[model samples]
Target chain A: MRLLLVEDTQDLAVVLLKHLRQSGHTVDHAPTLKLAGGLWSSEKDAYDLIILDIELPDGLGTSLLKEVRASDVAVGVLVLTARSQIEDKVYLLDVGADDYLTKPFSLDELDARLRAVKRRHISKPVVTQSVGPLSYDPTNRTVWIGSDQLQLRSQELKLFESLIDSNGWSASKEYLFDRLYGLDQDASANAIEVHVSRLRGKLVDHGLEIEAVRGYGYRLRYRLDE
Target chain B: MNDLWSIRRRLFASWFLMLILVSVVVYWSANVVVERSLREGQDRNLQAVAQVILDSAVKIDTVIEFELPYQAFEVLAYSAPERIYYAVSVDTQHLSGYRDLPRPEASVNAFGALYRGEPTRFYVGSKPIFPGSTERLRVVVGQTETSYQTESTTIAVWIAVAVLVAFTLLALWAEFSLRHALKPVIEIENDLGSRAAGDFTPIIRQVPSEVARLVQTLNRTFDKHRGLLEENRAFIAQATHQIKTPIAAILTRAELLEKEVEERSRDSVKDLIVRARYASKLATQVLLRATITYREIVGVREQFDLTTLVSSVLRTMDPSAEIKEVGLTLLSPEDTPVVLDGDRIAIREAITCLIDNAIEYTPALSDIEIEVYETDNEACVSVMDRGPGFTIDIAQLSGFDTSKKDPSHVGLGLAIIERVAKSHGGRLTISSREGGGSQCVLSFAVS
Candidate 1:
C-alpha cells in the first residue's frame, strides 16, 4: 500500500515512516500542510491512504482534508492527533476522515487501523478484508481462515457475500435468495436454508457466526466467546 | 435577617398605618363640622323665639309688663320635641313663667345650663319698655337640649363611621394595587426558583424600572462566571494536547527502539515505552476528569441507552483487546434498552476506562465479559475479567498511589470510574469473582 504521511514531529515522523516502510508500505513524508498540499496535487492518485496530522506548521490539516475530499481522487484519509476530545473526534469524522488515531498509539494499533481504513475505502480493484481469523479476497472470491482456505459452493459463496454486505446487520431472506439464485434459476426456497447452515458450520471455528434472525434473514457476527 | 419583611409587605404595612391615621383625622374634622352646623341651626331658632317675646313686651304706663307670645313660642316647638322654659325679669326679680329657669348672664345671648334637671339652651333678650327708658324688661327663653343634642350626636357618629369605612376601602384598594405593582417581582422569584442549577442565562424578561438594575447585575455575574468557565475549559484542552503530544513522540520512539535494540537491552526499551504510554494515559485521564467536572458544572445531562453506549465503546476497544489476544464479549438484554440519564461523555469515558483496565489486566487468550443490565431501580454495567483478583482493599485505593505493587497501575482509571458513578447518583463496586478473577460493577440510578 502507498501512504502519504503529513506530520510535523520530526522524531515521531521518522520512526513512523520507518515502521510503515518496514510493514511493506510505500510512504511519502511531509512536515507541513503546505508541503503536503504540494505533494497531494502532484501525486494525488499515487496514494491508497493519506495519514494526516491535525496541528501543522502552515495551518490545520482539516483544510487539506477538505481539499482532498473535494477533488476527484478517492483516497482514504486517516487523522493522527493529540487532541482526544470527543467533539474533535466527531468533527474530524464529519470532515470526511476515514479513520483517526490518537497520539501515543502503538505501532500494532496503527497497522490495524490502516488495514481497517483500507478495507473500508476500497477504491482499488483488489483488496483483502480480515475480520478476526477470517480473511476474504474480493478479487478472487476466496475466503481463508488462518492457514486454511474456506471451501464453499458457488451458491454458498454468493450467500456469504450477501451477508457480509449487510455489515453485521440482518439481511432479509428474500435478499439472500435473490443473491443465491437469480430470477431464472430453478431452486427450492429451502435451498438457501441448506446453504446457510452449511456455511455456518464451516465458519464456526473461524471466529465468525451467521445468526438467523427470527422473521427476517441472517447476520454475520464475530464469535467472541470462542 | 430571618425576620426581615419582604418589600411588598413593608410597603403595604406603611400604607395601612398612614391610611388609618388620615382616616382618624378626617373623621374627627368631619364630626366637628357636622355637629357645629346642627347646633347653629338650633341656636338660631331659640334666638328667634326669644326675640319675639322681647318685642312683645310693652310698657304699661311706667311699669314694664310683657305678654307671653304663644305664637312665637310655638316656633320653638316645631324645631324638635323638647321642654321649653321662658322667664321675664326686671333686674334680679323673676316675674313670669318658670321662675327657677337659669338666667342668662349679662352680655351672653345664648348659654347652656342645667334647668329643671335637664340640659337646656337659653337665649336672653332685653329692651326698654319706652324709648330712652333706663328700665329694661329682660326675657330669657330656655329649651331642653335632649332632642337636638341626640340629633347632633347621631349625625356626628354617622359621619365618623362613614369616613372610617371609606378610608378602610381605600386602604384595601392600595393593597391590591401594591400587589399588582409587584407582579413582575413575583415572576422573577418564580423564574429563579425553577431554573436549572447550571443555567446562567440572563433574566431578560421585562421588569419594572425599579427592579431592572437588580436583574442587570445578576446577568452580569452570570456572564462573568460563564466566561471564566469557558476559559478554564479552553486551558484544559490546550494543556492536554501540549502534554500528550511529546509523550506520544517518546512512546513511538521507544517502541521503535524496542524492536531495533539488542535482545538484552530490549526489556529496558520496552519499559521505556510502557512508562511513556502510562504518561500519555495519565494525561488523558486528567483531561477527562477536568472535562467531567466542567460538564457537571455546566449540567450537561441527557438520556441515552446504556447498552448501545457500551457496545460502541467495545467496538473502539476491540482492536486493543485483540492485540493482547483478549476476547471481548457483550451480554445485554435483547430488544430492551438499558437507558440512563446522565452526561453521555462522562459515562462513556467511565465505561471505556473500565474496559481498558480489563484489557490491561486480563491474560492473553482470556475473556473479558461486559454485561449491561438494569434492575428495578438501577441501570448497571459490569465488566468481569478472568485475571488475578484484587490483592488490596479497593476502597482504600486513590489516584496517585505510589505504594502500589504494580508501577504501571496509577489507579487513576478506577478513580475516574468512581467519580463518574458518584456523580450519577451511583456507586462502583469491585469484588473478586468466585474463581481467580475480578468483577467491577458500575451502577447508576434509573432516574
Candidate 2:
C-alpha cells in the first residue's frame, strides 16, 4: 500500500517509515504543510492512505483531513500526534480522521491501526474463525463451549467477548474496563477480575477453559474430543 | 464610543468663552456709566453759567450794556469744554477778549455730533453766556475737539484692562474648577491602569454630582462584568472537566475491543475510540485552569519533588519513547524540594502540554530536555525542544478573528499552558534557543 506520511519530525518520520515499509507499505513523507498540501492538491491518485501530524509548519492536519474528505478522492486518513489529552483525541476523530495515535506511541500500534484501516478499504475474509470444538460469534454475542450452549450475563458476555475478540492476546485491565463498562462508570480492577473469573467459570461449566495471560489479560480455549 | 469626548475639557472651554463675553459686557457698561456721569457734571456746570450769564446779558442788552463777569465766563468755558457753542452778534463786540477770540466755529460740549465738516454741539434755546429777548445776540461757549479725544482714550484703556482681567480670571477659574471636577475620572483611569484585567476593585471618591453618578454607574457595571466573566470561566472549566467521564468510558471500551481482534480480523469497525478519549483529557486540562477564580490565585507555595513527577510522565509516555527512538531526559537536582504555591495538577498539565508539544515536534533522533533550576526566591522548569525552533508566527496559530468560519480564537497547547501559568500567579516564558529549537519556561515563586 502507498501511504503519505505528513509528519514534521524527521526522526519520528524515519522510524515510522521504516516500520511501515517493513509492514509492506510504500510511504511518502512531507515535513511542512506546503509540501504536504502541494502533494495532495497536485494529484489525488498517488496515495492510498494519508497519515497526518496535527502540528505542522503551515497548517494543522485537520484542515487537510477536511479538505481530503470534502473532495471526491476516497483516500483513508490516520492522524498521528502527541496531543494525548482525551479532548484532542476526540476532536481529531470527529474531524473525520480514520484513526488517531497519541505521540510516544509504538510502531506496533500504528501498524495495527493501519492494518485495520486497510482491511476496511480492501476485500478481506469474514473476520471470524472457528477452531475445533470452540466456536465464537462476534456479531450475536454468543460463544460455544464444545457445542454446548452457555449462558452469560451481559457483563460476563462482554468479558468473554473481550477475550474472544483478542483471539489469543493479553489485554490490560484498564483496557478491559473501557470495553466492558463505559469510561465514566466507576469500575475497579477487582470488578474486571470478578467479571472475567465468572465468565471463565461459565465456560468451564460448559466444558471449556480460558487461559489467563499474566501481566496482560486472557484467552479462551477448549479440548477437542479424540 | 465617539460620544466619550473628555467632559472636563468641554466644560471648561465653554465656561471660558462665557466669561469672556460677560466681562466684555460688564466693562463696557461700567465705562459707559462713568462717561455718562462725567458728561452730566460738565452739562450742569455749563448750564449754570448759561443761566446766570445769559440772563444778565439779556437784561444788559436791553439796557444797552451790562457788567460782563469774565471770571464766571472763564469758569464756564473750562467746565464745559467742547460742550457749548456761543454766538454773540452784538454791534458793540462787548465781549472781553472778543478781539483775541478769533471768530471761528468752536467744537464745544463732550457730547458732540458732526455738523457740516466740524465736530460741534448745539444746545439751543437754553442760552450760554448770552440772553435773547428783543436783542439778537448768540453766544457760544466751547472747548477744542482734543479734550474729548483724551477722555475717549482713557475710557478705552480702562475698558481694555478690565476685559483682560476678566479673561484671565475666567481662565483660572475654569482650570481650577475642571481639576476639582475631573478628579474622579483621573482616579478611575489610574485604577484601571494599575489593576489587572480581571481585578474589579471600584474607586470610591467624593466627586462632583454628575461625575459622581457616572463613576458610580461605571463601577457597578465593571463589578457586574467581573462576576460574569468569572462565572463563565468557571463554568467552561467545569464543563470541560465534567464531560471527560463519559468520554473516558467510551475510549476504554474501544481499547478493550481493539485488543480482542487478531491481526487478520482487527480491521473492522471504527478505529478512533482511543483518540476520542485523549481529546477529552486534553479538553479538561485546557479549560479547567482558565475558569479558576482569581481570588484563589494568591500565595500558593507547596513542596514537591518535581523530578519524581517527570519520571512518572516518562513512564506514562514510555511505550512511545521506546518505539520512537526519542530521548526523554530530566535535569533536576537530587533530593531537592520544588517548593511552590500553585495548583499541582495545573502545573503538571502545563508541563505535559509543553513536553508533549516538544515530543510531538522533535524528530526521533533529536533530544528533549526537561530542565529544573531554582533561584533563591523562584523555581524554574523549562522544556526545551530540539525540534525546528518556535516559529515567529506561533501567535497567529489560533484566533482567526477575520475568518468567516468562526475559528473562535482557539489556541494551541502552548497557549493553554500560558493561560495556566498566568492564573497561578506565575508566568510562562517562551523563547527560541540558539540553533534550532524552542524553549518554554514556567516560573514560580519559591514556596
Candidate 3:
C-alpha cells in the first residue's frame, strides 16, 4: 500500500515515516500543508491513502482533506490529531475522514486502522473469499469446498456469494433476493427458498450448512466434521 | 408557611384589610349623621306645633281668651308612632294638655327629657297673648321618642348593612384584582417549578412591567451563567487539546529513542513512554470531567438507538482488544431497539472506559461481554468480564474514589463513568459475578 504522511513535527514525522516504510508501505512525507498540497498535485494518483495531521505549519490539514475529497480522486483519508475531544473527532469524520486516531496512538493501532480503511476501499474487486473450507473466487467464478471444486447453478452461485459476503452476519431474505435477481426481473419469494434448498442439498454431509436465522434470513455455518 | 412566600395571597390580604377598615369608618359616620338629622327634624316639628297653639290665643275686652289647636296637636302625632303632649299657660297658668310634663329650660328650644316614663323630645316656647301685651302665654310640647328612636335606629342599621354589603363586594373585587395583577408572578413561579433542572432558558411569557424587571434580571443571570459555562468548557477543551500535541511528541520521541537505545537503557525509555502516556490519559480524563460538569449545566441531548451506539463502540475497541488477545462481544436483542436521549459522545466514552478497563484487566483471549437492552423504563448497558474481581465493593464508592484502585489504573475511568451517569440522571452499579468475574452496569432512563 502507498500512503502520504502530512506532518509538521520533525521527530514525530521521522518516526512515522520510518515505521510506515518498515511496515512495507511506500510512504512519502510532507512537513507542511503547502508542500503536502504540492506533492498531492504532483502524484495525485500515486497514493492509495493519506495520513493527515490536523495542526499543520501552513494551515489545517482538514482543509486539505476536504480538497482531496472534493476532487475526483478515490483515496482513503485517515486523520491524525491531538484534539481528543469528541466534537473535534466527530467533525473530522463528518468532513469525510475515513478514520481518526488521537495523538500518542500506538504504531500497531495506526497500522491496523490503515489496513481497515484500505480493506473497505479495495474490496470492490474481491478475487477470493473463504468461509471455513468453502472458498469462492469471483474473478474465475469458481467455488471450492476443501480441496474439491463444487459445481453450482447460476442462482446458487449468486446465493452462495451473498451469504459469503455477509461474513457470518445473517443476510435478510429480501437482500438475498435482490442480489439473486435484478430489480427489473420479476421473481417470486419461493425462488430463493428453492435455490437455498438446492444448495443445502449439495452441501449435505460436507461439514457446511446454511442455517436460517428466524424472522431474518440465512447464514453460512461451518463445522470441522460432519 | 407557603402563603408567606405567596405574593398573591399577601396582596389580597392587604387589600381586604384596608377595605374592612374603610367600611367600618363609613358605618360609624353614617350612624352619627343619621342620629343628628333625625333629632333636628323632630325638634322642628315640635316647635311648629307649639307656635300654633300660641297663635290661637286671642284677647277680648281686656280678658284673655285661649283656644287650643286640636289639628296642630294631631299633626305632632304623625312624626312617628308616639304619644304627643302639649300644655298652654299664661304666666303660671296651666291649660289644654298634660299638666305633669316637665318644663324645659327656658333657652332650650328642644330638649330630650323623660316624658311618660320613656325618653322623649320636648319643645318649649312663649308668645304674648295680645299684640305687644306684656302678658304672655307659655307653651310646652312633649312627645314620646319611641318612634323617633325606632326610625333613627332603622336608618342607621340599614346604612350600616349597606356599607357592610358594599365592603364585602369590594373585598371580593380587591382579591380578584390582586390575583390578576400578580398573574405574571404566579406564572413565573409555575414556569420555574416545571422546568427541568439546568434548563435556564429565558422566561418568554409576557409579564407586567413591575415584574418584568425581575424576570429580565433572572434572564440576564441565566445568560451569564450559560456564557460562563461555555467559556469554561472551551477553556478546558482547548487546554486539554493543546496539552496532547506535546505529550504526543514526547511519546513519539521516547519510542524513537527506545528503538535506538541499548538493551540496558530500553527499560527506562519504555518507562518514560508509559509515564507520558499516563499523563496524556490523565489530561483526557480531566477534560472529560470538565465536559461532564459543563454538560450538567447546559446539556445537549439527542435521541439515538442505544444498540447502534454499543455496536459502534465495540467496533472501535476491537482493534485494541485484538492486540491484547482479548475478545469483545455484544449481546443485545436484535429487533427490540432501545432508544434513549443523551449526549452520545459522553455515553460512548463511558462505555469505552468500561470495556477498556475490562480489557486491561482480563487475561489474554478472555471474553468481554457488553449487553445493551431495555428494562422497564430504562436502557441498560452491562459489561461483564471474566477477570479477577475487586475484593472491595466498587459500587459502594459513590462519587470520586481513588483509594482502592489498582496501581496501573488511574481510577479516572470509573469516575468518568459515574459522572456521565449522574449527568444523565442514571446509575452505575458494580458487582462481582457469582461464578468468577465482575459486571458493571450503567443504566439510564429512557426519557
DockQ of each candidate relative to the true complex:
0.25, 0.02, 0.20
Each prediction's TM-score against the native?
A: 0.68, 0.50, 0.76
lDDT of each: 0.80, 0.61, 0.79
CA lDDT of A3 in candidate 1?
Answer: 98
Location of the lowest summed lDDT over 10 successive residues in candidate 3 chain B: B399-408
- Candidates 1 and 2 compared: the better one by TM-score is 1
Specify the highest-lDDT model's number. 1
| Model 3 Cα lDDT, one tens digit per residue, A1-226 | 7899998878788888888887888999999999999999899999889999998877899889989989898889989987777777768978999888888777767876785566445423345676666677676456766556675545667888888778564689999989987887666557677678767877766777888889999987876744
Q: Between candidates 1 and 3, which one is better according to TM-score?
A: 3
Model 3 stretches astray by more than 4 angstroms: A21-24, A124-226, B1-6, B55-108, B111-120, B143-158, B180-184, B194-197, B204-220, B255-271, B293-299, B333-336, B361-363, B387-400, B405-408, B411-425
For candidate 1, the lDDT comes to 0.80
Evaluate chain B of model 2: give its TM-score.
Answer: 0.67
Estimate candidate 3's alpha-carbon lDDT, on a 0 to 1 scale.
Answer: 0.79
Models ranked on DockQ: 1, 3, 2
Q: What tens-digit string does per-residue lDDT give for candidate 3 at B1-447?
A: 665757666776786787778767766777678778988988888888888777777778866666777777777766577888887778887656787888766577789998768998899988777778787888888888877777777777787788778878887887788778878888998998976666776788778789989999999998998888779878987887688877777887787788789999999998888788788878787777777666666667899988998887876776677555466767786566789999888898889888988998877555688899888888999999988876544456444456744334566778788777877778888888877889999999877
